[model samples]
Target chain A: MSPGPARGPRALTRLRSEGSSPEAIDQLLREQRVPLVEGPICTFLWRGDADGVAVDHRMPEIPIPLPLRRLKGTDLWYASVELPRGARIQYRILVRRGESTESMNDPLNPRVVGEPIGSQSVLEADGYLTPDWAYPDPTVVSGELVDLRLPSRALRRDAQVTLYIPSRMRRDRRMPLLVVHDGGDFLQYSSMATVLDNLMYRRLMADCVVAFTHPGDRLREYGASAAHSRFLTGELVPHIEGSLRLRGDPRGRVLMGASFGGVAALSAAVRAPGFYGALLLESPSLRFTEATPSGTFGDVFEPVVRFVNSVRAHPKKVTDRIFLTYGAFEPLAVPDRAMAEVLERMCDELRVMEALDGHNWINWRDRLLDGLGWLFPGEARLIYPG
Target chain B: MRQVTLLGPLDGVDLAAEIAAFGVDGPVALVTAGWEEGERNDAEVDRRLGGGSRNLNLYGRRLDILESDPGYADAERLLRTQIDELRELYLLRLRHALAGLEVIRRRFAEAQRRPGSELDAAIDAVRMLDETHTSSIAAAYEHFYAQNPPHERPAITRHREEVAAIVAGCAAIAIAGGHVGVLNDCLHLGHLAALIEERPLLAWSSGCVAVSERIVVIDDDDPAGRPDEIYDIGIGVARGMVALPAATSRLHAHDPDRLAVLARRCAPSVCVLLDPGDRLELRSGRLADLTSVGVVAEDGQVLRGAQAA
Candidate 1:
């Protein structure tokens, strides 16, 4: 529950071993799942003959590559590292096979997370469980996803948009409109479609007209870009409003983003105050001078820092409802908490929840239910049982 | 007393069919107070019930009468404020109680082998907490009534009697669910719970909540999520079970752990899943499981028929 990764007790199994045979390694892999997480220690496995093997991961308050060594006389390469409990880090198993070497997803691992960058194998530590609601249910009537393009005069380009219309949607049913940032990544990684369908089927969240929008130059464009704001408010929203039967009120619109995308959503709300009634921000990179900076992430946060500072100085009431979620193991935790404090004072309702995980796509995926459910609570369907 | 029939949502116009089964040819009193501002829209009900069942709107009259009376309004405002304050405290206590229960659950989960009796005791503890919370709410209402009884007050008495007179003329009563809080308030205001006693009643959804002894808003939709919120106690017309209408869509009925928690929390009092086309009857505080309905069990099981508590 704190804004930090948890350190759990070491497993008594004393799992790490040396000089394992190829056959023994294969037997072990068959016996248990790959990337075996045993308390504080996590053993990663790779079976290909390689010049070098290392794990490309973002975790442990340090951004570094974890190297793996081949077992003596065995083809299997293994690396065991001490990871804190509930640390869910996404990584790629880089296999350097002589001159021709490339990054690869762990073949033995079934758990994978995706982003616009690409998909990575997820090493989920203890205390992390897949939320059941994220899976697609065959029982519910499936919604439709239409590929549409909006010609944005502000950006001087045709923007690609993936629209989600609930199965029960009709002309009379004016649903909420959600505009997501880095929308393609969310769709690919977060299982966003499956989550929405499941929530709607369960009556946990109101069905919405979701417009998933991906950015061209994500960092630069999403870094509090006025042009981006214009695209959303002046062009995109107006187009959706005229074409579809939306709730057509500030309260009916929701803007969602994560990290730099989060900055875009917040700045958009700040520029057009009360335009979006609810905001779903996850692991937002709200870096500021007065705020808690866990790490100096990158130069891309310069615009975000400036925007966040301005908001802190003159905190204007932007959105009515705010649903914020962050991984305790994430660097953005402290900053997310700072933003939550300010939003709590300004917003009508604010819910802040965190998992004992790291800043990853899956963590964001897990939080969709809490954020969406709080904002657009579905009303009970009055179906009379005969 | 006449047997009570608690149905799920009345989407199929089952009110007339159910009423006709009672072999009553007379008028069926309709309480649509749950509709709040839209209580007067009985056109759909009329079409459904046809010419045979003439409707009597007791809630509409009471709403008008209460709105006109300043004394009743002030008293209601005070009662609402009092209940709201109590609700905050109840929520806090309920959280701690649930947390304590969670420890036991975790212990069982981590155990090599879990015994059933120990799990049963853990469930009983949850039931105690729910009952205690409901009792506190019931006490607040009782306290409010002792100070300001609607039936005794001249401001409310004249109108209450008028509504009671209308109900006295009707053969049966059907309470349709809408805004359950409003329905409960109107039912209390009109004192219909006592007046409609011994009348064959057909209620669905929030109407089932209104007639319950303890009102708890359950959402099995998110099985691993938030616990049930302790709503105010309902009128004691249908007292032995917590009726969950729209269970098919809203509940994780297949999840045994979720079912166990739901059922055990309202122990002795059965937790019935009122899915569409599902009906349950209660006669003399006993659930009449005529349709082989699924009821939650204390041992993390969904039992049917005579197996239900």
Candidate 2:
């Protein structure tokens, strides 16, 4: 039966009449439904055969089990939490059914993003609106994509890189270059090629070449590895510059990536000063240390944490324009905010934006238009007429 | 040497003072093609140039050719009618595309279900429509020029020689602003692109639009309130920039989205803001480092000439 208008403070009477427990009725009301934005709190409700329910989110400091309580008179379970606007996060519900406990995606949420481990339901907080131009415009000419593999002496492996060339450029012309990390995922999942095409056709940026470099060993290479940094600066950059008609000046080059790739992009910039004009870091994995009750450093992720800490300590080493973004709902918010603070002092131009989406390709995809446009606007073209 | 010295406006910025900075000694040539009816009224500009400026009067000179030649005026009138009709039809299509874009943007932002693929389709439709319109405009422009090559006609050819003679003696050429459309049409008619070679040129306001690679018309708060459209291709003397004169008054500076769109629309080259006191040296068709002035940054901030440093 369809949910009728509420009669009083207690709602969902139809679900209750159907022999559904309070928890089940609550789940029915809350499940899959967009959370109503009431000031600072988003109230979430869930109902099922489980005796108990809890939300497990990606935030590092938040407790693992944020238990949902059932109403005293009804079988419905409810929970409320304060969230900043534009916080996009992935979350799972931990349900206790009879003798077993299980974690699963929200059956009510239609939006989801795939992860290396598994898919998670997306939660977009009220605040950020995706720009209209972020969507692909088919009317504009699309860039040509060619796949090529290069042997990397630094990493001792073959690296696959996809090249995107704007159609407007002549064969003899040398264009600026944008190098994207975690290239395969960005191309396949982020719809980056479409973004580049629209941005170029609109003349929001210069007609340039883009190199999407796929990693051989993502987990290791993306986490503050010197070898990976060397491969990018030594082997890949030189190869692309020599083979393609790309701008030789470093001021025309930009490096972009998300998550571990964000860290990797920054690491490369730190390693090779004056190599890139700008760096676009989306939800960069900037955290490296864990503090105990005693207020001392505890367990750490070795190289990744060490690299992040060193960069934070010496922010002036990388002077290019830094474009940083993070999701307010994710645990990475703490570290990303801290990094933004440090970057503000060092870089001449630094823009930090917080989105209402999670740490996924979708979030990164939304940032490409703004990030790339700010990083590389060609010589000058007219956009407004008086 | 191919040199271009761009200024904000001639209203306050003295042409003689500017020419003095260039350190050129000979008489300065003036291109008043953009002034339309007043193209011949160069007494003030001449005085400002220390009485050594010779007005090319491209606007009146083109009319002189058409009026003097038998049947040329009739042919030109017919072509004008055809172009006007085409422009009207293109503007109609532009309205629809802009309306469609507004709808898609609203729906994409408000819909609980992210309108991902559908939003893309709508955006593409608008782009396609714009592209189709622009291509048609370009084709029509080309056809008009083909049917009437000024070099083949006697009256027009004779006027071109006179223009060339005036340009030969001048050390620099100065272009003043007026209505951009009128300015661009007159410039094309006189073929200043061929005549202004090697000599340093000083241009302000609509003159910038006349020489830019493309002409984009934007009035954020127009009575009709339409999205900015690419009107036509320019002479491309100023290769990378899209010049917006009287920017502070005409543009909606406080609106980031509006500013961002404007900044993006003219990428690569800076979205040049021709405000008062702004002087830029554009060399080899690209803006030079030290003399490059005022640009609209992607962050919706206007970086004036001083900030260019």
Candidate 3:
């Protein structure tokens, strides 16, 4: 929830003494859940490991290998880290045997957050509440997900657009359009459709159209590619606008992305300034370097660096509104702050949110309610404005 | 002027004896416009009011006026857009301010000191915001009327006259609440606030909110998703009083911090809680009489024997 050094009680600090027995340690591991949370203290434990073990996580990108300590006279290794109240973490345990190391989930914890490739162990501390709007409610009239395809001459490929329409939505109503990059990933990991359904049913937000676009080569295309931007602005926008009943022009059009998707959104907006009325970016890879784009994500970040550097150098109005959010624990936060500072001066209205999270799908998922709702509010908004 | 009777929701019991007690001998004019399309269900309300009753159908009449007059509809639409903008900003500021209030209360519990003045000022600041917002919304309504007075326009004039005629024939007016926003809009459409001046007005639930000086919507959700907001300017017939119908069950009255902030926010306007078996009369913009009614104090205590200073 905040950007500060986390400090809380260390749960197993008392057990560091020699008086502690193996049986008591077994009880603590069995009775209480591993990655045991007592307030902000998250004590991670591992039983079977070779020479060494470390908590491999996404947070504090500065700390690459966070190792767990072996309980003296016992095989149990415990590592406790303080997190803010309600912070959710995804991590893997790196067990080292001699010179070789293997990545695996925490055998002790059952909870996991699914990713495109695999799943990460989930560490939910006190105050981490599953948003009420994300649940699939029987009372809420759910939306329909329809497959849409458009041939992009610029990219020379067929773009897969999954559209979300409100249940029993008529073709007559001129609704707002939400164009989402990396849409398939969001649908799979975040339950985006279910959230949209609940939001409309609860009148938390308005009923509108959501177009999720999948990139053929996400890294190459989403890294500020002119073709991708052209594909969206020139080809895709015209096709969707012509067929679907939507608000005229850019006013009701919102572009949303996460990570590299965010980079693509900002790139497109900057290239064709004011093309998008609003931009919703989450943990965008906004890092800039004077040399070039040679980093952890690869040299594909060259175009990304140029755009970020240009925005920082010459800050000008790009859109009517901008909504940017980043996790306090992610390395991208530093650049996100720099970008947001420049963005606030660049847009008529700007809303920025920071949470005690890392670069993960759940963080982006939870933020949709505020970002999307604020950009294109429904008529029901006035009735229950709160 | 005598007094107007305001009570709790008419659910299980009937309001016939109460209307008769207020000296209403002839048929009562019922305003169920808040019920939206359900305004036709007057049987339950008529039985509650204890005898002859006529449903005013202000909601339907409002729709008729909107269809008949494009100019009125167009102007009202723009004014509503302005109100929506105002409400958007108000709700945002109110949420942040409400969050700070909880921090103030937490500090009190943590420090266990004899309440700090600085923290006290923070609470006052939130109260001032609520007051400022109320005034701003009320002024917008005044501006809307100044530009487009309903009585002057043919479509609106016709409907107002028709509703006024029915009320003139009735002995008293009975307002039942459903949706506060819809009810408030219809009341303004029919000009019920002014019409009730001569006739005694009996309202309950959101109707209580609709007739008060300022409409404060008290929403109770776990984890308090969004803070309870200052909805809009009400009819202002029961001047200087914020009416909370069924507040006993809805509100966390035991929490001193919440009660104190609520009482002081709508200050000068006494926060009156109207529950079952509770009745109150307002005279000259002050509480004249009451029965089993609870009023909030400036110091955050719910008390009886509330008198206008």
Candidate 4:
């Protein structure tokens, strides 16, 4: 069954507020291109084999099962959403037709960010620019990534971790260690290795051994589990240090993660106080009371909130420095702000960067330099010492 | 953990007597970058440090370096221009938001309602604005440093070497108050943070503010009546404390609303007033075992350490 007519006069709809001419919009739509806009509403059009399409976003307030209308006299399906002026959102096209039961990335969109489960097409509304440093260049020297495995009795399984060592690393030198949760996702999707290389080469951040920890069962483990904390502080740190030469001082260590991984990082730091110097938390799931709007994760609330609350109540600091980054567009912004307030007195230095982007790898990738620079300026300058 | 002693305005405090207590018989490292070219009369400071004060003329040195090296000068100018542009935009936004906040405040007053979430959201928005401005400034600074690193530049390298030698030879470093911005610039340009390395440091007024984690500029008497502007992120040596030098004179301390704003803006970092003759000892970027004075409480009241009476 072939689709209808190849083209028609009603094939293009003039989005008046989008600021682009109808001819341009028609040209773009005909070419199966995503239209860039500088306004609130972004009309995402997908023309293909699909009975219906819906956008799944990180915002918890927006109700799910939202359907897109099919353009009359054409196979084009479209949905207009009012996003923040300059926020990046990841959305997948949910095709309701044929054997394709799964939500698929918009093939027409060139900008895509990878994830553990799959890839999602990125939409930067209102002229959002991808940070210059986030994009890797061939001219820049890249870091080396080595895969390692550690037996975790706490989780009753082995965990795979990717270690990124800077190309400028010397054997005699004692480098800072950054252990990141959701390791595999970050390495593949966030372009973290490239970021580290650029930062170190530019002398923005010090050379460090980044341990990317891959999870076994992320949903079960990353929700502030004490066992997972033990697995990280007790098992992982010792094992990594014993095998590799890392600076023994707690001041030389950093714990980092995003989303559920953010919760895991903080939980680990709180469990073993003074173990790490700094913490990099990106859009942590602090609130367990409510479910996300997109219904990405099932409504399971208690453990994560309890752990976050416990950290807030802790008398002294778990670490010296804390770097917090959150998206202005996400539902977690308010909770993250509250968490920051709770963490203010708890740490010596607290630096925050709230970008105009949704909860995704791209935003997290952009924040690496800022977080690292804030936490280790002394070490950063030493990279290009006199 | 370097030993740090913070003082009020040196104009009122006995500079000579202050240094003697530290048992500093060797030449004291005098950092007068804050004073700019006005750091002329050091006879009194010399007398206090047993006439062996190694005046590290950081401001003068920076000027000399800028005059000699075109590349450094151009980079510095470009950075300053970018920062100034950012600052202007920040202040403009801040003023507009503050005005909006006033309107919101009036609405709450008329309704006889306590502004709760609305006020918090407004404040957060303002803070976010500040954060964006700070990030831009930092990015500009970082870009400049990457291109023309002070370590790589011969002019800066020479100044740092001299500063390092002076710092090493000195028993204690005394950072004097002047234009806080100038002081901070020279301190950063000279790479004083790395050079000082665990030295017992004494600072007053702007010096104390410059050493802290962040520099907040506030002046109630100014024509614009600007809200406290977080000017610069400091060297992080003096942590967990926002030092407000000449606080009593410049701040509208009697007004609860003003005091509340000051106290709330830089929370977690204890906002302390450095009045004349006030003395504080800081260790490991925090208050030492000694009783800390001039802590501003959330109740809009300035608290003094209570003796067990």
Candidate 5:
């Protein structure tokens, strides 16, 4: 049976409140081929058949030029249209059936509500709070501990390290090591030690020690500082090996960190693949040049990018493992995720790539846990439900 | 296992339990703000817990050492000395126990590197040591706690007093129990509840607002003036009233319009209990039932739940 008359214009009005602009609204109506009604208040409607049967009330009307719609299959309809190009307009949607206000759970649209009804959801399109997954799990084991201290000749600061020995020692008794930047914060905030202990107990990934190096003075010590990288390669690794009694195989070491630390870790790992074996980076701060005072972005991030490109362009003698993660929440990390995608493509060409979720700490921690489980599965216990 | 219910100020006991649950073993070291009985409680917990018998120790340090005070110098000196002694004991014990294992670890590594050594045998030996160490530490703590129970166990009388304090703090009336008891208590009062809806009370800043329909915890930091980021109101007794404890503060001005709208929507039934300090109870939801101890109203008139309805 044929459904009721179309209500395309009304749908447009609803879509406007959902962040859709008039132009986008018009485009959607045209694409849907919905009929438009003109009167004291203009109304538009559309009717469509799914498998020879007409879908009833799949129509919408626009009270004004508002880009609104009552979407089928969802409890709430949404529109993504432009708003005066950079104009931040605040809007809300009210459902009404001949003056009787409809509840948030309108019998029509079926959108998922993370919150309760009668509340309007805010849209953040500029991506400040956009969710992105970034940061990989730094694998550290309880018994297999390694400590490294690197002093940068360039920056003149002491870099600290606390590495975890992996349960899976190589047949040659040599194990891979991961040198992680932002050691103190990573260990505490990210619960690195706990992750290591749990992963080691479970026996998920290969046993590896992560030499967690603290950022000297987070803001100052991270970018435009080749000294940190120098300290890592020159001073830290040797000190960790001598002090912690760690294995000295080049194939058994990786460089890892998040955000600015991720950039440093990647740069150091790329420069010294002879010493470090892998690069585990999350949400690298690539906007080093965008900051005013010093355009160090070119000197630091560009070089690292160029180095990665060069390495991919010309196959190096020593093969390295590269793992990348970024959060969906961070707008700054979007470029980094893009860069990771590029690296993933390169790794795909080389047939070796590991990428993980980057939404937030929730997603990051889960990814780290899962990745560590896969990388260093020691002895399987019942998987703990998060 | 002996249930050692500790009474008095909660210092780092919760944190210690959480960390120990992560697999750290031996006697759980707790640095407290001290018990009501003062320094004597330290020795009491230690002796009772078999600090002398099973090699398990319960070391309690006075929080005064960390707190700012004019006599801080003497406290600092004493704390440093005790800490040094504890460190020495811990390292000495750890060294003695793990000395043989260290030798085995080195030898195993060497064997794996050797041309004709059995890789599986060396790996198995290292694995065995790792498992033993992790399990033994966790087990030792369990054994220690089992033997010695804390002196000041929480009594039924104290529990009732706490519950009463929670109930009396309510602005709205109604005695709720079961899973909702703790939640209602916390909502009316400010203390963190232990249970809500059969689950442990998981109310944070936002969760507290989710407990009430009349009030929503607006993110003062939210750039968008939209109130969509709200959860369901909890099943607490004060579900219809917005209890703004410490109402005169600057923090109350974040969304005054929203607050006004909420109060107006509730109308003559609206009740605002400004907590100056003390309990406000509502037994039958009537204005006469709302016995205010130290509460005062500013904008809206104070009415009991029944009168407002």
Candidate 6:
């Protein structure tokens, strides 16, 4: 027998009863299955009003087999949406759930300190904010296959590395270098070059060199394998230094990537202290499981933990600064929080921010400005130009 | 150098002796038992000496010393002090040294601004001295003592030389290099990959167990009587389907069964190293005892012959 819906507080009638409407009951059940935001989400507006806020709920375009529903009950709402694994969306509710007529301010708004209930407040989606240092119109300088060979061992097969340098450059001195992993996706989706150009035009960030590294064939090679670390420490760094004519100091070096790349960049910094002072991580895949061992990409997580622990134990050995951002909706948020806690405990200066969205390049790009301001504040002065 | 002699049980005596010998330049200040025991011994020795000597005596005058005596003290005491004091002077130096050594022994196991060439030179000096100075291995105790002098240095350096030689030989074989990678508690296939990548590696028993391609997967840890799986051996060279020396049988009871299965499964003939001084020479993929090393056994039946099958 099919389970029944509640008639009252305690009584229930079976959905398959002779006179029952199974479709309606099924719909109701489906509606109830929609998940709500578990924790609080905060939004900060650089420019916006507190009134006339309306949040539009847009369902994912993909077809989902399971019956999904959206239910606004009490002070929260639940929605069954099929989102891509790493996609992020920014939204605001049209009105408060409980207060039908009230124009109350969102309690989760970071900008609003205090607002009485029943007061209508406006919510808006902030445009994605690229770092001022991002290339405004990044022309692909060249995309070529590069081999990463280990210096100490010849038996090891070399990994195929792809390097992409943004064509936009300044005439003055050498530009700061930013090395990013997952070059293919970064070149396509991140809009990193455009962001760099805008930042440069505005004088927010100094002219910087960016090297986008393509992940190798093996998933482990890019993410969890020790060879990945070696590739970065032994091969990639030297390659960048020699080929790009980039400054080799910590201040001039930066590493950025999303998901596994996020963890990989951080791992590289840990393995080679002072190699990269600035790290931009987005929705980092920091979780480790035996079934899906992190070793596939490279031994990123444990080495990071060891390096951070040692740094925490001996602060004198660590001087690299970090800027980390994560989305609340990301599946790896819990692990990301754990990583953040570790970094917080070790670093003398660390900036961490949680977005009011899931793991998406959209949210990552949106948060880049803030992360960059904190990481390269002097660059900000260059962008704003006093 | 300052010298220190730790008086306690045998568990950590070797380490203590090594440290004392390397750390101090002077004769080690001996402390037997606890502080109370040492004080009692001091009183006994003083009484025996008719209260005329300030020296503390141990082992019936085989060793006698004063911490401040100029005769037996070394330079280590002058260079460094007690462990606690040394740690305070350096940033986690003591803990790092201990942790580093532990990591080198396969036990449980960044960034900075640009410093000038002078700073690099200073650091290079220390690194050079650490790498060189084979004497450091033997003089560890003397070094400690000299930094934190407790007693006078010995008149001869032969003892230091002997200790150094032993340490050099052992360290050369045991420690691969100065790096050690600490992984998570659980075993992961990625660790094997990392090992191949040449990151100094450490792994628990389960970690090692999973590395081989073929393994007798025993279910001893399970409460239920579960079957064992003979899986493919791991990629590590140290592990394979082969017979272990007879001496290992005392340590592992399942060795016979494991060996039998391996012999049947492996190609190119299987060789077993038996204890009691024996070698088994293989001919045309068959096993035979060579040099009358030890008796052979198959299927719980012992075969006694100079050329046993």
Best by DockQ: 3
The complex in candidate 1 yields a DockQ of: 0.09
Stretches of model 4 off by over 4 angstroms after superposition: A1-28, A36-41, A48-51, A59-66, A70-75, A97-102, A150-159, A169-173, A239-245, A289-302, A312-316, A378-386, B1-309
Query: Which of the two, 1 or 2, has more TM-score?
Result: 1
Better of 1 and 2 by lDDT: 1
Index of the highest-lDDT prediction? 3
Every prediction's TM-score for the first chain?
Answer: 0.81, 0.81, 0.91, 0.79, 0.51, 0.56
Cα displacement (Å) at residue B276, model 2: 22
TM-score of chain B of each: 0.88, 0.85, 0.91, 0.92, 0.25, 0.22
Give lDDT tens digits, candidate 3, residues B1-309: 745777776555457877877775798999888776668877867876775798889988888887788787767766766676687677668877877877877888798966678667877888778878877887888898899887788988888888899998998888887767778888988888878888887777677778887877664432214455677878888877888776766675467678887887878878888776667787754667754578888777888753422
Q: Candidate 3 chain A — worst ten consecutive residues by lDDT sum?
A: A377-386
Better of 1 and 3 by TM-score: 3
Question: What are the lDDT scores of the predictions, listed in order?
Answer: 0.74, 0.71, 0.78, 0.73, 0.38, 0.39
Report iRMS values in order.
8.2, 13.7, 7.2, 16.3, 21.3, 27.9
> What does candidate 2's lDDT look like per residue over A1-386, in tens digits?
01112231233344556656656665655553544334455544565556898877764445566677775566456566666666666788788978888988876566677865688776665674665656777687788999988898888998899999887753223477888998888887787888788777765666888999998878689888899999988888888889876766676578888988888988988888878877889998877554533223333345778887777767774655789998765668888987787877655568888866668787887876667766764322333221
Clashes of each: 6, 29, 5, 3, 83, 109
Best by TM-score: 3
lDDT, residue A251, candidate 1 = 72
* Candidate that beats the other on DockQ, 2 or 4, i.e. the better one: 2
User: Candidate 2 chain B — worst ten consecutive residues by lDDT sum?
Assistant: B218-227
Ranking by TM-score: 3, 1, 2, 4, 6, 5
Docking class of 5: incorrect
lDDT for position A328 in model 3: 83
Better of 2 and 4 by lDDT: 4
Candidate 6 residue lDDT tens string, B100-209: 43233232111233334543344344333323332332255456545544222342233333333333332110010000111110011112232222211211122222
Which segments of model 5 are wrong by more than 4 Å? A1-155, A163-175, A217-225, A286-318, A328-360, A374-386, B1-309
Candidate 4, residues B45-77: lDDT per residue as tens digits?
A: 667656778888887888878877877786776
Candidate 5, B86-148: lDDT as tens digits = 433343343333344445545755776532234334334433443443344335434433542
- lDDT of model number 2: 0.71
Q: For all candidates, state DockQ relative to the true structure.
A: 0.09, 0.03, 0.10, 0.02, 0.01, 0.01
- Chain B TM, cand. 6: 0.22
